[model samples]
Target: MTGDNERPAYERGTGFLLARLGSLTARSWTAFLTEHRLTQAQYTVLVALQQHGPVGQRRLAELVAMDARNIVPVLDSLAAGCLIERRPDDTDRRRRTITLTGGGNALLAAVADAAAVEQDQFLHALNATERARLNHLLRRLYDSHIPEAPQPG
Candidate 1:
């Protein structure tokens, strides 16, 4: 049996690197977005809507990798801020579609600028080529996990 001070080989290797990288990235994003009065989740939602356009709530939740129930409060707050609107889906009244309002678009533009600056500062240790490689690897990892469509609720 290993003592408390001893870690298994895997724990001290790839697992440690992955955990540290994930935590650092998450913290950097949280701090950067919070400076603009947005949580990581809100920023993610806005980015998704910006990219995909008017999307159903469930689909939005999936795109952002959030639970449907958790997404409701975020959507509610965005709607209350006049950043987005929820309208009944033309095809399915039971489903609501979310779209960014002009205000939301403007906010997203500002946030995108801030995010770019934040990313530069966050990855200052990496060169342009390294950053590009890191981004490509991360995208591949995500694509391997998340499906193209939201799983039916």
Candidate 2:
């Protein structure tokens, strides 16, 4: 393929749209999270815990797309607030599993409600059907790109 002014297929289609949408969605979500005294990183961790329950620190870091080293300070602050607890893993003495405390559960519930409002605010320009369509398309786009892990036999 030889062209001076031609662009790749994705540059003009789904990829470009997804990049723009992701930036807009993240910005809106971060602002909402800040109002609740949570950073985007903290909110991501909380959401993962709420969805996955107790998990090892390494696994949590992977789920939230954060470096393992950066997770410690956030965990420390949450632990100090009684929002999360760290306990020794039964099978691995050197590892600790983090779980949300009752307070953390309550706070996440409230934050989730606020997040719903924030989502509505972000999508206010679109009609209900358009919003639903956009969400469906976005999910499909992500699902197509994310590589699937092989299952152990």
Per-residue alpha-carbon lDDT of candidate 1 for residues 61-99, written as tens digits (9 for 90 to 100): 988889999999999889988989999999999999999
Model 2 weakest 10-residue run by lDDT: 1-10
Report lDDT (CA) for all predictions.
Answer: 0.88, 0.85
**Candidate 1, which segments miss by more than 4 Å at Cα?**
1-14, 91-95, 141-153
Which ranges in model 2 have alpha carbons more than 4 Å from their true place?
A: 1-22, 148-153
Q: Quick one: best TM-score, which candidate? A: 2
C-alpha lDDT of candidate 2 relative to the true structure:
0.85
**Position 68, candidate 1: lDDT:** 98
TM-score of each: 0.74, 0.76
